[model samples]
Target: MLLSALLGVCLIPAHSKPAGEQLGSPLLQTCFEEAKKIVDDAYKYSREESLRRVRKEVVRPHDALRLLKQPRGGTRSAVRSADYMAQTLRLLQERVHHVHKRSLNVTDLLSEEDLNKLSEITGCASQVTFPSCRTTPNLNTYRTANSVCNNIKNPRLGSSNTPFARWLPAEYDDAISQPKGWDRTRRFNNFLLPTGYDVRQVSNNILSTTDAGVVNDREYTHMVTMFGQWNDHDLTFTPFSPSIRSFSNGINCDESCEKIEPCIPIPIPPGDPRLPTGRNSCIPAFRSAPVCGSGYSAFNFGGEPKKREQINALTAFLD
Candidate 1:
């Protein structure tokens, strides 16, 4: 009984035959004819509506009115859309219908050679089928970044797909593999050239101090970390907050923090939330530092009280 039941299940038909092949069934033929008629009418109405709008826009006022007034197909001046009429006739052709039905039997899209070529281009290790590799959003970027990240030695410097791959190109992956001279730090400008952006314009736009090429250590660190996070990691995927303290001489300097460090502390007026308020408030703290003089001189913080000369020097700089 079990063997008989299994045979019966295997013998069952999965798909039905086309309407044309079922001519013996009168009911099926009648239903198919009705469906074809409905489709024809829908196609006709859409064409007619589109042609009517185009006719209104293209013809002169008098000619349009004459065409509208005349009966269709009489040659007096009937409104006819040649493009739509031609399309409708072609679709309704017997040969086109036969070709459409035959084309549906095709399932496989890629040939063996095409498959091999794609695999070679992508460097995919295992054999992959076309259907399985259907294009998905951000797949290209992820693939490129993944390949590049695999070859890189330094885990921190290497670009990752941890967050998301935006518009990553194959070149970026290939470039990352190439040796970039003695410097280990990944500089995007050195390896990857930015498209659409003017390099000189970008450099000029960045606010630089009088010591043009020299940047404080904190700024340098910040710039490196920021580039690694933005370009390499794809900013969207990075988990950390963007706010970075790029100065060593921050208010929390409790230990022996007297030595010269990067990041010039810009003294804002009192009540600015950036400065810490002690027993004397932020005003006294800001006032303590000797005012900067004309030109870009180093900030003077000698153990001297606020002097009249120092205040005048700052005022002159401001002017």
Candidate 2:
């Protein structure tokens, strides 16, 4: 069933417009052209900075905290490499997002080819696209650290830094990249989703433990919870965006309560036990880093608009 679903997704037509068709508004074309230059410059700078850091770390071993902290194994190295790539992709996404927002109306009119061109300009096409897996002598003997090339036929399946396989199609507020619940006015099934703070309050009311109601389990200890967490870490890890600042605006996520891209602050309700009851007192949070080229509607094989899907930093399969 899963294979069939995956194949179905893979087989969806690109739905590209005719080659002679007009791209879009002049403003949209201009935005994309400017974006291309910005993306190219950003990649060049990132590459140069990376090389400089490598050289510095190699020459001054004492300053190599990042290298020293890394575990001495192929798995750790592979995971670190994935982390670097994810970070780079996140930055690229931020840059493109900024450009898109500058002319949102025009951007919304962009076709699949326009988005594909943007992806290529940003170097995300190379990052998200899977490479051909080469079988090794030890292929069956050991599992990879990042779980890449695990399936000889499908190298990226179940791999770290890949998009989660969705059983159902994603539903976004914009029917494209914006997250569900992003717009408070947005409705699902004739009902509105409650705010995060309201849900927290309900949890506090029902799940909070009192001294009088403290119950002990005979069969299990705290180690069960600890082990569960450890096991869970091995299976999936969705990392938050590394930046604390919003991509759309320069506002620091910690200081702003706005539902800007990357910052999704939890508003505190009135008469809360701990937190203050104001917009400014909300808990700060960041959106998870997205899989490169996955969120945009234009990039997917399936012509349906794709919502932002978080990257699974660990293997989907048990490691």
Top candidate, metric TM-score: 2
**Every candidate's CA RMSD:** 33.0, 11.3
Q: Quick one: RMSD of model 1?
A: 33.0
State the weakest 10-residue window (summed lDDT) of model 2.
Answer: 1-10
- Which lDDT tens digits does candidate 1 get at residues 38-109? 334433543464357446747545334322432222111101111122122222232223534544211122
Q: How accurate is candidate 1 locally (lDDT)?
A: 0.26
How many steric clashes between backbone atoms does each model show?
1, 0
**Candidate 2 wrongly placed segments (more than 4 Å):** 1-115, 135-142, 166-171, 300-302
* lDDT of candidate 2 over 1-319, digit per residue (tens): 0011122111112233332333332323344334333333433443454346567635534224323332233333332333333333343344344444442332244566755554554445665677766644477888776677878788888877677777887777778667777888888889988876785588668887779998899999999999999898788766654344554445766577888756787777778876677758777666765665555422323344356676666678764
Model 2: lDDT to the true structure: 0.55
Q: Assess each prediction's global lDDT (C-alpha) against the native.
A: 0.26, 0.55
Best by lDDT: 2
Quote the RMSD, in angstroms, for model 2: 11.3
lDDT score, candidate 1, position 208: 31
